[model samples]
Target chain A: MRKFINEPSKVAQETLEGFLAIYGDQFAQVPGTLAVAKRVLDDKVAIVSGGGSGHEPVWLEYIGPGFADAVCQGDIFAAPAPQSIVRAAKAVERGRGILFVYGNYSGDRLNFDLAAEELQAEGHEVLTVRVADDVAAAPPDRANDRRGIAGGFFVSKIAGAASEAGLDLKSVQELATLAADRTRSMGVASAGGTIPGTDEPTFVLPDGKMEIGMGMHGEAGVRRADMATADETVDHMIRLIVGDRSLSPDEKACVLVNGLGATTRAELLIIARRTAWVLDQAGIRIHDLQVGDFATSQEMHGFSISVFGLTPELQKLYDAPGRTSFFSGANRH
Target chain B: MRKFINEPSKVAQETLEGFLAIYGDQFAQVPGTLAVAKRVLDDKVAIVSGGGSGHEPVWLEYIGPGFADAVCQGDIFAAPAPQSIVRAAKAVERGRGILFVYGNYSGDRLNFDLAAEELQAEGHEVLTVRVADDVAAAPPDRANDRRGIAGGFFVSKIAGAASEAGLDLKSVQELATLAADRTRSMGVASAGGTIPGTDEPTFVLPDGKMEIGMGMHGEAGVRRADMATADETVDHMIRLIVGDRSLSPDEKACVLVNGLGATTRAELLIIARRTAWVLDQAGIRIHDLQVGDFATSQEMHGFSISVFGLTPELQKLYDAPGRTSFFSGANRH
Candidate 1:
């Protein structure tokens, strides 16, 4: 891959500078960190989220307006630092409180925890929501052992909606936790991503076979198997999601067919349509379905399926109005 | 390649159905086709543009509010029917008249011409602007033969800005034409896409080489060569765009480091930072810069850089804010 980076190490920092130039309006720079947050939330509970830097609009894209009060950005596939997390929380804290939501990575957990303590010390209430919705990352017994992937969207939407509903800090935290509990994601990778200027694949798969249940950073898949037809692949993912959720025949759900890094809209719709049919055949009702690159892997050639069991209450939050850079919709009101 | 589509033909229709279901309040269907427009502009010069289905948020995404009065959607990479185009134009046209801006393609040109005729017969005045900014698709003598790729952003932004300025029909049309003329694009492709249910790639490329200047549909590239580094690729493209436009060190331009399909944000910025630097070295100050899958070829692993020799006046229009489904920026006005 021919890349224009100064060095692989500087890629994330330089990119943050550019994003800050455009999105700096909604975010204030955190001292000594590559984090940004909303300019105002006086007395309002603040929601903070972060992950690797490769997913363009996922973490950072979901910030602003009714979403995260602030976001901490780290290098590609690397967690943000403790100082960064604390600064992000402080940057968006309006004194109502602060809550941190992040993928279930050890580094992210440690840093966010450290940040939580710092916020609490400052006389502000602070809570944390760890989103570990990836089913393939670990067994059900250790669901939280899985890494957070595209389910970040569900977490983001629900959290933003809860905050916008004028819920207090505890209520907001509970709402986010509830949504995270019900959501699950599974991903597959056709190819691995390359570090800028590097020629080696981050992970490898045999030609004509896909790494099912692949991680966003091209982590090893649960299995390497022959490339299945579209229906077969989708059916496998849908079955796992449906089986795990144990959706009743009349259950309602919201679906997201996410492109990791390089999947196309054409392919996304393919997943969306088939996934919808799978649900329809199972007599599951879909209130809303979105197909796009909501979460990506810097153009990795694979995708993930994310599902959230929804009720009239959760569905309303899922449909809540949002003003993200990529996705938008009406408020639950 | 797991997809959500049913019949190949139904992908566009069904996805649009979902779009309306999710965004019904912000948009209304165009009577019969997969096209839609904002409801308020029944009398403004309806600006309708579209090409294929997969590149969501492009034609339809740039629609709404201050951008396109309405948009027409074609079946993935297929130009919409004349009937659909006519209906879309009629629905969005205010007394100000209507103008259609789209890529320079035989299917698009044929259908848009027929739609213009259809509208004219009904006593609706209409005009068309053909975007031919792609530098890699055609030879210089056949400049009009070049295709429109990511440069569509430049075209759409200018049109919306002009219309929002309340320029008369002819003046707006001319401004759009000028904007289209001032832009050029060069793209690279890393992978190919599969239509839903199909096993074959829409197009194919050697694993170690890149299809330079490929169209957004996996069409043939201007050339296929060894994968160059990102800096080299950006440099190669800059040379072509500057040479074609005779841009000098003192010229001002806007840059779009557009993902062809599935390239990640991390990758886009990796290249975009270099793109910005390259332009800076040329003594060209970017009036604006955006990087993402503004135009794509499904999940292809490539991106394109579009340079628009924007004048201060044109840049103003480009910067105007409007809200669309896929993308929205506030107009500086």
Candidate 2:
């Protein structure tokens, strides 16, 4: 493996240690648990999210003001245990209750739900909103069954904003659900990433071929097709996202062109350029555009496009200042 | 050849177009020139930095309030022409002259110096400070002959901050030069990236081997050795930087662990963890720590470490609010 890792089995723990060393002033690990919680707490609803480890800057780096209050990280491509989730919730619970926001995946749902039940038994109010935004993961009739992907970024941003706005648990939960429902994403993979400690990649594609809608962990995508140009790939992904969201002309939306690991910022911008043109052609006014690595799959080479159709309320929350190790939404002075 | 580019020849232009499309509200292209100027120019000495285009977000994304007032972009892996540099300087000049800060490359030095002459002839004061902070590129006696690597980020940042504080052109230039002198960096590459419009990789490494002190564009490094673990690599890099800068116990410094291209954030944080430990062992206090892609060679699988020993004034300026598309320094609310 060409990675700078020491031991494959300890990569996840070391990654978290490294994160804390750099950002410990703003975030800290919950004692005896693989849960990272914000160093400062507010007397409002708490927002928590997490899943696997390899996708750095996802749930971990997103834990800060106007983002998740805590994150429970699992091992590479695995879900955090229920105990860790409960520990994270307990660390941030401020008596306004706790709301769980995360990508829609079976392991994540099972663990978070179990954690919710435990928190409820302890007399703490708990709610959950699973982001189901990957259009190619399921048909329209079963949208809720779709895997979440990069659109979970939107879900977390809005949810964290609502919580920061001092909304009650139920209200924050509702807004988070709405954000998840309105968001859609699709991704194409040029190459799969290798899990640490393994010499082989998670998956492989023949030269000159690409996979559409690949999951963050290299799960099978909708199909494998011959490689296409950046514009062509973005057009296809945008079509799937727009159609799945039933977005119409004259609507407003926030767009996120996310680079899966190994993709350059230049390529993301190129993808963003094509994305804006397509949205403009459809008369969809882009209220905000964010292009970067919000979520990633190790060193996987590809990108994902996410669109969050916005109501005025959602737009306001989305525009609110957010500060995180990975995503920064501060306005220029 | 697994990239999302449309045409390799148009990659640079399209990348700029994509950047403008997303950031048009804050920046604009100088008409008929490959120069991007901040939309709102201040009355202070203008800060301009640019070079080749492949390093997305380097000089282009750095153009904004509290950063570069303008940036002149050249084609991939080439310096901007003298005319473009002059054009960019004119776009942001407010009778307070211009301060040009960028990496020390022969091509860049030639063009920027030529532009400085032209701008001077037009009755505009101009100053230049070439960043030469790569310790591995030269011996101590010939430090000024060293290549500028990721440490240019610190130079632009301090220069931009100095200018934003309403310092005079010469004062800003002095502070920028001071920043350049105090900064040190070293990089290692496991694999090289392919340039746009080309099917061949820029350089190649045999399996399980890595190159130390590699240049941004895959220029030959100091040596090739068997790949080492993250901690060992970071130790060697930190030693070279500390020795070159003569960093001492109790000295405060800012750290930047920059990913070249394809390295994952997890790996970066892992590197950061070791970086902090090593510095701490030497009794060097970390004033600020930033781990991300400040400067990158497109899709190159490696990273660099930059340490900026901070003076009190420099530390204060570095902490001042600065926001760009890629960086944010607003205090958390």
Report per-candidate DockQ: 0.33, 0.61
For the predicted complex of model 2, DockQ is 0.61
TM-score of each: 0.82, 0.98
lDDT of 2 by residue, B25-81 (tens): 778898877789987877899999999888877767887667899999899989999
User: Which candidate gets the maximum lDDT versus the true structure?
Assistant: 2
Off by over 4 Å in 2: A248-250, A330-333, B330-333
Question: What TM-score would chain A of each candidate receive against the reference chain A?
Answer: 0.94, 0.97
Clashing pairs in 2: none
Q: Would you list the C-alpha lDDT of every candidate in the order shown? A: 0.76, 0.88
lDDT measured at residue B231 in model 1 versus the true structure, 0 to 100: 72
Q: Please report the candidate that would top DockQ against the real structure.
A: 2
TM-score of chain A of 1: 0.94
Output the worst ten-in-a-row residue range by lDDT, candidate 2 chain B.
B324-333
